[model samples]
Target chain A: MALLDVRDLSVTFSDHHGRRRVVDGLSYSLDAGGSLAIVGESGSGKTQSALALMGLCGPTADVGGSVRLDGRELLGLPWPALQQIRGQRIAMVFQDPMTSLNPYRRIGGQMTEMLTLRKGLSADAARTECLEMLEAVQIGDPSNRFTQFPHELSGGIRQRVMIAIALLGRPDLLVADEPTTALDVTVQAQILRLLADLRRAMGMATLLITHDLGLVAGLCDEVLVMYAGRPAEQGPVDDVFARSLHPYTRGLLHSVPRLGRDPGRAPPARLQAITGSPPAAGDAGPGCAFAPRCAYRFGPCDEKQPEFAAVAGSRRVACHLESPP
Target chain B: MTLLGVEDIDVVYPGRSRKDMPVRAVDGVSLTVDAGQTLGIVGESGCGKSSLARALIGLAPLSRGEFRLGDSIVRAGERRWPRRLREEIQMVFQDPVSALDPRMPAWQIVAEPLAIHRPELNAGQRRERSMAMLDRVGLTADLAMRYPHQFSGGQCQRIAIARALVVEPRLLICDEAVSALDVSVQAQIVNLLAGLQDELDLAILFISHDLAVVHHLSQRVAVMYLGQVVESGTREQVYGLPAHPYTRALLAAIPDPARLELPAVLDGEVPSPTDPPGGCRFRTRCPHAIALCAKSPPPAVAVNGHHAACHRRDELTRPAPG
Candidate 1:
């Protein structure tokens, strides 16, 4: 069995205006020690889908469908059961370390809380383990860092602390949502390297959520491109990024500014930007959500939502085109 | 011709208490931006590129060095910038939504610069220019009256761009202007900036942490580290054969899918600006640091029209000649 199986997952939010499904018909599976990345622009439901996985969505959110781990269903579990599963089985690290880490508490105190409470380790043992995990993340002078607050450390160090704390529970799965978006390129690279190393050492499956396609290739084995709460494409990172099938995916690939190998060559005068912005949450019509922005959009695109069907290899695409463009 | 020439610019922030030493956010850095060109300044956070931007605009304290804009030379400790100089330099900030006034409509926000600097123009003329600028930035006249909250993030950014360009500034300092926007929106804005640079012959000091975006827009590039220009050259020179260890590591760090291998990340964090390392600020994290690198700051060595501030620049680039 796969380490994680999410099938037909949907998330909706209701208000006086009525109900809108922010995430719809998302399905993917990850093997043990595998890494998968969910890439999309804002309001694509990438973050919402990950939130639905952890049951971390706000009270206004209504999540449906199935999420299974090791042959066990997790969609409708009670709060107490879900709480036990949270830090013990699946840990999460957010983008902004300053916001994620408690400012009022010391680093050592925060790191050991998970171990002492959930793992039933004594205070001394948890401290020693936390120090080791900090070292594992390659933080220098782990003892000095332990006593300091989150604000005392630099942005990179604070993020490392977050990773150390997340790994303290030694969860089988690590869900990182835009973990390096707030950091500088060099610092982001360091964080990505650390994550890759930890995954190798711990054999943990990772569900990485990010908008940058550039970031997906190195760390992730699989890629799932999301658009307006639907799966636009999915396949091996190298294969899918090498030749994206979906029109939306292609547009995104062209939109990003890449550092060309031939640096002496002049950059293109203009990026082939998708002319229109993404549809707002709950604003997608009955037809394809990305049809308005798609260059190869056709008659069938406006009439009905295309089915997510298989393409060559492990790739799947949700577009009306008869073959890959 | 050089539209802006910065010479040994420094921005130091006084500490909160006597015990805390003042932070030298921007150590003596110098560069030039030519007319109708983009000088891309790239570095990680706290590298002082933003401080340089603010110092250029007279927002930050210019502790040392002077900047030459055309024939006029503005020295450090100038209390107020000349009115004409102020109009010649405009800025577009990172967060588009928050940068705009929530209460004001898009048209007024665009015209606010005109009202401040171009007072001779009547309200109608300002409105006319505002609509034209809005159109130039891909925003429609219909949305001009709408408040910031009504527009999307991209649209708000368009409004911000309109405001900056409405006055027709010669130099536009974009400090991470597109960093907050989504990739698609960022492309639109980037294209708009490029198009405008040609149309108005604007000189842009584009500062961003993302190297790819900087590589795309800039003709000349300067790599900053802890408030100093570690390397500066044409886009082709710097991106093609980065001499400085920091520059090479930075370029290698970009997670480009076209590249086969994973990025080679530098170890350790940027030391606190309050108390930087004795000689080189980057030596703590630099992979090619030598014993001499710890004694004194490396001087800039010109290599094929590119300048790198490293003691062993030639040795590192040409470890073994062909």
Candidate 2:
């Protein structure tokens, strides 16, 4: 069995407006000690998918899926049972470290709480491990840094602290959502290296969620491109980067500016812009979500909702253009 | 002559605590911009690029250097400004939402620049100018009455661009203007800025922390490090063949889709400016650091058209100190 298998996951939100399925027929499996990256623009439901995996859904949102982590069903697991495994079995590091951490709590207190409460470490042992965790993330002067508040640290440092907190439990899975978006390129490199080293040391399965294709190309082992609310494409990072079939994926890769190009040169050619705004979740009909902007779209793509189909080796695209199954 | 000339300006942020020393944000940095061109100011956070851009526009107080627009020197460190000095330089801040007042509608925000500069113009003429600027930025006049929260980050950026252009200023300083937007939005804003540069024929000082963005938008690029211009050259010279070790590592660090084969060079996080290294600020992390790097600062060495300040400028150095 895969380390974490999410099969045919569907989540819908409802209000006085109507029923809207934001995540439609999403499915993927992560192996132990492997890494997968989800790349998409904002409102593409990356964070929402993460939340579903955590078994944290809203009252009006209906979730139908199979989520298994290490042979345990995670979707229908009870709250108390899920909480028992939340920090210890599957940890998560959110995007914004500044807002994720509490302003009033000291860094040591947060780190120690996770260790003592989740890992069953004693107070004294937790304290030692807390310092060790801080040192592991390469924070200079861990002893003094433990007493500092979130505001006292820089964005990069706070993010490192967050990583330390998540790694304290030594969870099998680590889900990082845009961990480096708020940082500069220099600091971003440091954070990416730190994550890579930690993952290797702990042998953890990582799900890196980000909008930057550059970082995806450098760090991720597998790439899953999300568009609208579905997986537009998935493949090995090298393969996907080499041959991006979906128009949305193609547009995203082209949008990133490259170095060494003349500044005054005309901007790189943008493929057909995915022309219209993202379709509302409730308004999704029986058609490819990207049909409105796709240059190769046809009647079949508009008449029926496209499903996942294999293209070349280890690559899958959700479009009718892929030679019929 | 360049449209805007900044002659070796030093900007110092006032000290906050009694024991705290005054922070030299922009220390003796100089650059010049001609009409229909762009000069990109790039550096890590706290490297004083924003301070330098603000000082050039009379927003940030300049402790020493003077700014001359055409032949007139715009006075620094004061709210009151001469009419000619005020209209010649305009600034676009990082946050479009806050830089533009939230309570008022978009039209008035764009009209405020004209109001302050050309008070004698009639309402009809001002409205016409505001709509023209909006159209030039690819924004419809219908978006004029909408509040800031109603628009996307990209559209709000376009509004900010329109506001800065209505005065018909000779210079526009953009400080991390596109950093907050999404990728699609960032591309749109970048293209819009490039298009506006052609239409208005204005000189722009674009400040950003992203090297790729700077490489795409600048005619001439100046890399700053701890309040100093560590490297400066044309886009081709700096991005094509970087001289400074920092510039080389920074260029290598940019992850391009076409070139994923090159190994990354930059390693540790950028150190804070409050307590930088003693001699050469980048020596602690310089790959080719020598013993002399600890004793004295490296001087700028001109290689062809590019300039870099490194003790070992000839050698191709990585990010890690050997």
Candidate 3:
């Protein structure tokens, strides 16, 4: 069985404006030691989809569909059961390290406490294991870092500490949401390298959530492009990037600024910018969510939604267009 | 014509306590922006890109050095800016939403600059000019009556651009202006800025951490590290043939979809700016450091104005034979 399998997942919330489905009909699977990336802009419900799988949704949120981990249905699991699976079977690292980590507690205390409580290890053993984990994450001086608080460390170090904390349980699946978004460019590269190393060394599956398509190419094996709470395209990263079938996917690929292959003195060519912004959440019109922004949008694009079905060359795309332009 | 010429400049912030050392945010950085040109300043956080921009705009304390815009010259210890200089240089901040006042309508927000800078113009004329600027930035006249909260992130950025350009500034300093925006929206704004610059013949100082965007928008690029310009060259010279080790590492670090292989990763965080490394600020983290790199600072190695501050600039960046 796949390590993680999610089918037709949907997460909705109730407010004064009525129910709004932030994550709709999301489906994908990942095997052990594999890496999958969910790419989308903000408000596309990429984060919320991961939250739903982990049973971390708010009280007002209603999550439907099946979330199976190792053939076990995780959706609607009791709080106690979900808590047992959270840090053990699956772990999550957020975008911001300062807010996610406890500022009042020392790094040693926060890290060791989890091992002692969950793994039933002794104080000395827990401390030893945590120090080893920190070293594994490439912290130059783990002992000193253990005594310091989150504020004392740099942004890159704090993020490493967060990853170390998540690894305490030796989770089978790691859901990292924008892991390097808040970091500097050089630091971002370092963290990504660390994650890739850890994934290979520990043989853990990774579900990376980020807005940068460039990031997906180097680290992730598979990519799922989400738009307005729906999967627009899904396939191996190389194939999808080479020949994107969906108009939205094509537009996004063309829009991002890339360093030229051979630099020249000529002015930069204008980017192929999409016309409009993403639709407001739950503002669906029983049609394609990307119709308005799509350049190759046709008659049926506004009247009916396209099915997310498999196409040639081992890819699943949701668009009226049959093949690459 | 040299629209903006910034000589060796420094920005120092006093320490909080007696024992604490003052933070030297920007140290001895020099560059020039010609008329109708875009000069991109690329750096990591706390590298003093923003501090340099703030220094140029007269917001931060310029501890030393000087800068001249057109015919006006402002030196160290000159706290006040002349009225003409202020009108000639304007800035657009990082966050589009917070950069604008929520209470003010779109037209009013754009007209606020005109009210202060061009006092002779009546309110009607100010509104007319503001609306025209808005239209040029891709915002409609109908949206002009609405407040900032009513607009989307892209629209808010357009409004911000409209406001910055309404005063007809000769130099526009965009400090990570598109960093807060999404990719599609960022492209739109970039195109808008290009068009506007051509129309007005404005000289722009674009500061951003995103290398790809910097390469796209800039004619000349300056790579800053620990408040110093490590490399300055044309976009081709900098992006295609990076000489400084820091610049090379930075460009290599970016994950490019076109190139799927994981590039070299830079190790260690930036050293504190308060007490930077004595010889070279980046030598502590650079991969090609030797004893001399830790003893004295590297001198500028120049080739047709494309220069890099590195001891082994030529030896390290020799083009591989085909």
DockQ score of each predicted structure, in the order shown: 0.73, 0.37, 0.70
Ranking by TM-score: 3, 1, 2
Encode model 1's per-residue lDDT on A126-155: one tens digit a residue. Answer: 999999999999999999999999989989
Q: Residue B180 of candidate 3: its Cα lDDT? A: 92
Q: What is candidate 1's local distance difference test score?
A: 0.90
Candidate 3 docks with a DockQ of: 0.70
Candidate 1: which stretches are off by over 4 Å? none
- Candidate 2 lDDT over residue span A1-325, tens digit each: 7999998888889888778788877888999999999887777877788888887776677888888888788887788898987878888998899999999999999889997877688999999998999999999999999899999999989999999999988899999999988887777878887888888899999999998888876667898988777899999888788778787788766666765345334435332233434554536677887888677888898899888777777888898874421
Q: Rank the candidates by lDDT, best first.
A: 3, 1, 2
What are the clash counts of all predictions, listed in order?
0, 0, 0
> Lowest-scoring 10 consecutive residues by lDDT in candidate 3 chain A?
A260-269
Report clash pairs, candidate 3. none
lDDT of 1 at B183: 89
Per-model C-alpha lDDT, please? 0.90, 0.81, 0.91
Question: Among all windows of ten consecutive residues in candidate 1 chain B, which has the lowest summed lDDT?
Answer: B257-266
Q: CAPRI verdict on model 2?
A: acceptable
Q: What is the lDDT of residue B190 in candidate 1?
A: 91
